[model samples]
Target chain A: MDISNLLKICIKALLNNKMRCFLTMLGIIIGVASVIAMLAIGNGSKQSIRAEIGSMGSNMIMISPGNGRFGGVRQSGSSMQTLKLSDYESIVRQASYIDKITPTVQSSGQAVKGAKNTPTSIYGVNEQYLDIRGYEIASGSCFTESDILHANKVCIVGQTVVNELFSDGTDPLGQTIRFGKIPMKIIGVLASKGYNSMGQDQDDLLIAPYTTVQKRVLAINYIQGITASALSEEYTDQAIDEITKILQTNHNIRIGQDNDFNVRSQQEMMETMSSVMDMLTVLLAAVAGISLIVGGIGIMNIMYVSVTERTREIGLRMSIGAKGRQILLQFLIESIIISVAGGLIGVVLGVAAAKIIALFGTPTAVSTFSIVLSFLVCVFTGVFFGWYPARKAAGLNPIDALRYE
Target chain B: MNEIIRLEQIKREFIVGEEVVRALRGVSFTITQGEFVTIMGTSGSGKSTLLNILGCLDVATSGEYYLDGVSVRQMSKNDRATLRNRKIGFIFQNYNLLPKTTSIENVELPLMYNRHVSHSERRERAIAALKEVGLGDRLTHRSNQLSGGQMQRVAIARALVNDPVIILADEATGNLDTRTSYEVLALFQRLHRDGRTILFVTHNPELASFSSRTITLRDGRITSDIRNDRIASAAEVLAAMPKEEEE
Candidate 1:
């Protein structure tokens, strides 16, 4: 028999039992819908995290002091004080991939401006710190290079600091805010960055020239850390490598010796986070795959019942001239039609579900790859599960089947 | 006349729980084209088994059973199926018309298995066959909507639509009233008169008079095979009977 006629016969048979066919398709529908929705949710979270990391800075590399050994006991990384202004200068002057570099020192203190007072961390950095950290000035100008040379007491205040130290109606630019008995003039207001992934407030900080904070507040000659930005995100690894080589030679560290400084790139963090997200997405898809198998079993069960119930019909068809393979093909086509149709409907339902999830403020990304993959899986499920029942039908003896009233 | 069927020492056996029950015991027969023959027997007499073998639904255990000069015993299962499709048509006792299907579509069933038949040709042949069986006006009526006699006529149309070499009917009117049975038998007589080969199997001895030849089976063997010179005309009997009120 031709494929068109076979399809017609299968369709007619299915339509004769409309309710049963629809119920049989329900399992597949739910399976595919959940698969798509789960993967979308997983992919959406991954995208959001990547965007968050991107906002921090894609090409930014940080050089911090490594752990120090005192009395044969290892101290924390921050307490080492191994990074210095000279090391930062050597990197700035020697590294070819470096775009912008800055030395940083940090201290926590209370900022008091007349009646308003708030506790916040004060960061000492040059103007390049804003470029490396992807920060923009909201209002007022940043301090100049001359400010660092003169050791001027000018700072940039974040939005949270502005809100805390100044009244709602008062202007904050050029306002002098005292930091633990040291008053500094506010040169600019940094752009408002809402929060990090960890729910920490990002805009509650202050920025000043490193020389001023090192000389006046902290009273230290060595810098705490250095931040640098590469020419582009692709050059981050090369920039880190060049900075490490320059630092190693400047510190006179020979080969095979542990360096006193650590270079970390945001790109590395992005790759690690991406891999974790990929794993989570695969895990979710695997869980959803279990439901698909259950759905396939449902198809198998129904097909077996249908073959048993239609034994006489099979006999009649065989008597008329239907070959065994023709009967097998007929049943197989029926199952495939059911699953593929269910898969298409499930795709629509899943996309709608994703949109509904997005409305609830969770990110959802629907990828074409997942849709196509699920469709292929549905086809395979139909073939794999429909095999046994169709074979049983085809192998039936016509004489016995006809007598199977 | 061309010999349409030749069965030589055909035997069939069944292994029924340690007992080898013989269904056919070396029965031999030959049927020619344009012959109307009847094989009559009671239950357990192997007439059903004979009809199954003749219809190509079952293979004989040991025999050279030739259908239209081709040895069916040597044919593959699929080849036998093709031969059945090309050469034989069957009318069952229950009519076996697919319920909830229209008369024309039921008639189109056999042709659907013929790959050489185009879609339009199938419909046209089905319509022509139905018209031949006096069901031209009820082409779209579902089997359930038709009377018993009408349903049997639809089955006859299905058997005729394939243009096979012979029609094998197993107790074709076993489910009908005497009046309806005579009506269907009259149609078969008409087809037989039109030079169609037909093999009719039935337990009713009264139906034997409607065929030109009658064979009797007893104990898995042919008890008698005789030609009838005084065959009764079903159309004449149906016409002479009293007419009943239509429902």
Candidate 2:
């Protein structure tokens, strides 16, 4: 039979039994709606994690001073101040994958500018630290290499610090900020970067030259961490390899002894975060799949009832001239009409649900791939559930069916 | 006239509980092309069984049934359906037109089963069939909207839509009033005049008198076969009938 004619018949048949059809389609509706909503939520969570890790920095490798350990056991601290300004100098000279390196020292204290005073963390580094960490200078120049060599206590304040300290929008240049009884001159301001993935206030900070922080502020640091950039994103692994080899040779730690510091790239961080989200996505999809199976079962039950109710009609059609496959096609088409219609309606409801969730301050994303996949699953459910009842109807003998009063 | 259908020693047995009950036993008959034949019998006299076999709705347990020179026993269920669709049209006593279906759509049902007819052509043929049944104005009326006689007419139109050579009607007038029955018989007469072969099954002898040939069945066997030289015309039978007086 032609599909168009079968479709018309199926539609008319469904229209005649509107209540029954709607009841039958409800299962598919719920299935599709849940699938769409769950997928959207899962994708939203994944994207959030990626964004959080990305905010840390792109291609910025961290070389923390520690021996890599498995489980909870620590074999060694491994480094005796092998990571210093001279070592940073050697990395920039010898490593082909080195982009920029920054030696950092940090201190936390109350910083005062004018009458406004707020307790916040302060970081001391050269100009390269900003580029390595993917931070942009919002308004003023960064602490230069010359300033670091001169041990000039000039500082760059973050936007949050500026808001807390200077509300008049007045240029804070040439102004002195007191931190730990030491007054520092402000030279520039950092741009606002509201929060990172972990909800950390990225804009609440103070930046100053590393030499001043080491000599005058923190006073006892052998460099906490060395932040380095790769020549390109593709060379991150190579950059890590070069940094590890140089650090090992300079520290004179041979194989079998753990290296002094660990080099970790942004891509590794992103992969770890994405793998966790992938697991979550799979779990959500599995739950959605269970609901879809329930939906298929619902379709099967409805179709069985329909076949039994229309036994006389089946007989009549058979006696007239319809083949078994014709009857099968008719019932199958009816089931498909119900399923596909439910799927479409469910998609609309699901997208609306996503929007509502988003409006409630939760992120949601409904991709076209998910929509198309849900629709196809609906159709597949129809066919899968429709087969049994259709076969039963087609296998009915016309003589017995007609005799069925 | 050449024989259009032949049944030789046909037997049909049904398993009722543990025992087998024979519905039709060694029934043999031959019907010529364009002949109007009626099978007359009481309830459970195998008349319906014979009709079912002839209409390809059931296969005989032991029989050699031929339609248009092809042995029906050799054909599969699907092939039988094709033959029924192409050559035999059936009219049931209950007027089994699906409820909520328009008269035109009911009439077009057979043509829809036949894939050779396009949608537009099926509609045209269904309309023409309704017109032939004098229901040109009521083509859009659903089965429930029509009276018993009108519904039966719609059923007849459906049976005739495919232009089959043979029409198998089972108790065609059993549910109608005498006057409506006469009207239906008159319609059958018009169809017969157009050279269509018909096999009607009924218990009413009055209905059998309209056909040129009548076969009487008793206890699953043919008891009598008689051919009438002159059958009463449907109009003559209606003319001799008493009229209902208006209040």
Candidate 3:
């Protein structure tokens, strides 16, 4: 009737069938390990994404043009050229929340160097754009406002472009490079930035002044996208709001009419990415939960077999004056001990599993919360699965049980 | 003499798929203090069922069974278990010792249910019981490590550890050889002589001769109840009985 008696009986029973008890605990072990490992992988991926998004300037915002208008026909946003230089100038002058603004005009062309020519994108922007988008000059000085005013063809090249053209890691500052018959002077080399989430070649770009791009390279008065930085991180929302209102009024669009452009902050992008990662983690956790359920079922099945195998023992205890509750408690304690012990072992295995996967170049981080949750899940499985078998053993008729062969 | 146990019209019926099987048919009996009583019956004569009821391991279908002035039939299931723990000890044919437990631990089991007993006292009593059964040297042996006769003696020690008012034995010597059974019976006789009330169930007539009183059951009813005023000691009975040749 006392807990110590039940504990002693449980210990003896489990020790008697050490192999079976270990095998039974194997299911729980796999269950907890899988749950922990899967959650770690999922959470690690989420953290990776957040870090990636954070590397992009938190105060930065991107504005892309909307679809072009036609007679009863709509065009894709990529085919539109609704953004203009005046809109960029207006944002800089009229929007108090905007700290710096720049327009981007992009085109792909072959850059000729000695005998090597490589096809790559040429992006046009001002000196402020480099600071706004979190860039630093590795070598020579960036083109200043005087360069933009003079409509200079001076350019800054990405590290990959420099590597491709120079090949010897030579200082290519103030050198001449030709893009589609337009020869330009390389004033600076942009610092190396790794690939983004979309796997874009961030350092394989060539930068030129917006005026030169519009007048000579692309030959269009409209810009493709506008990049801007907020005066402060706290002012990003205000900056985005003021830009939207200005663009909407400049385009002369009525209420409820589709705007000609879209404005988005890095925070919004990070939030959207986090939600996607959250869904992914939950999905992985759910899949792992199925394995835990299977483990619970295994425990139930094993406990039933154990009760049947120990029928005579149960009867003997009853005859020796163990109450129904005592029998129930003994069996239940046996299962709980197995499950809890398995849970502890599984925690170690799961952490090691996560670390191993991480060593193998997979993103995985074991969270303390997941460990506690997995351990609790194991205890729950013990009680849930051990209940029916314990009850069956407790309810056995002493005469029949003692007589069981 | 105080009546240690009484059975008033104890009737137990079994239900088997809408058919009723009468295991015990209105059997009534009384066992006085310090009396060694044996119930003799073949299989299915309800002697085992009677023993189960007397041990408080089974409830009768209709009965007014009393032990030491307490009505067992009306006691709650937990109370019945407590009564079994405090008032009765059971010995079985197969020894029913927990296979994983040492002899000393097995003897301490019943006392574990009685919280009022101190741990040292329980251990002391268990050791004393082992000593009484001539098993003081084998206290640490598991059931499988002991011989058939030694295992039975250990079971007896476990039964007597609590010093219950009655020792209920259901075919205590059924699994033993002739020599071992005689040894166990002699141990029982010595226990009885020490003023312990004992109720032993066995179908073996030769084994029934060792008890002070015998009740025979036939077809779920008591066929004969007789008191042997001059019952011989188990040693005398064993010495006179014909021994079987060794295989």
Candidate 3 runs further than 4 Å off: A70-74, A110-120, A138-140, A165-169, A174-183, A231-241, B13-26, B60-63, B118-121, B219-223, B236-247
DockQ of 3: 0.66
Question: Cα deviation in Å at residue A190, candidate 1?
Answer: 3.6
**Candidate 3 chain B, poorest ten consecutive residues by summed lDDT:** B238-247
Question: What's the best-to-worst order under lDDT?
Answer: 1, 3, 2
Q: Which stretches of candidate 2 lie over 4 Å from their true place?
A: A67-94, A245-261, B14-21, B176-183, B204-206, B229-247
The residue ranges of model 1 lying beyond 4 angstroms of the native Cα positions read A67-75, A93-97, A108-120, A159-171, A178-182, A191-196, A215-222, A241-261, B15-20, B144-149, B177-179, B233-247
**Candidate 2 chain A, which ten residues in sequence have the lowest lDDT sum?**
A74-83
Candidate 3 docking band: medium
What DockQ would candidate 1 receive versus the native complex?
Answer: 0.68
Among all windows of 10 consecutive residues in model 3 chain A, the one with the lowest summed lDDT is: A1-10
How far out, in Å, is residue B176 in model 3? 2.0
lDDT for every model? 0.91, 0.87, 0.88
Give model 3's TM-score for chain A to 2 decimal places.
0.93
Better model by DockQ: candidate 2 vs candidate 3: 2
Q: Write the per-residue lDDT of candidate 3 for residues B151-194, one digit (tens) a residue.
A: 99998998998899899998999999887888899999999999
Residue B72 displacement in candidate 3 (angstroms): 2.1
Residue by residue across B48-109, what tens digits does model 1's lDDT show?
Answer: 99999999988999988999999998789999889888899889888777767899988999
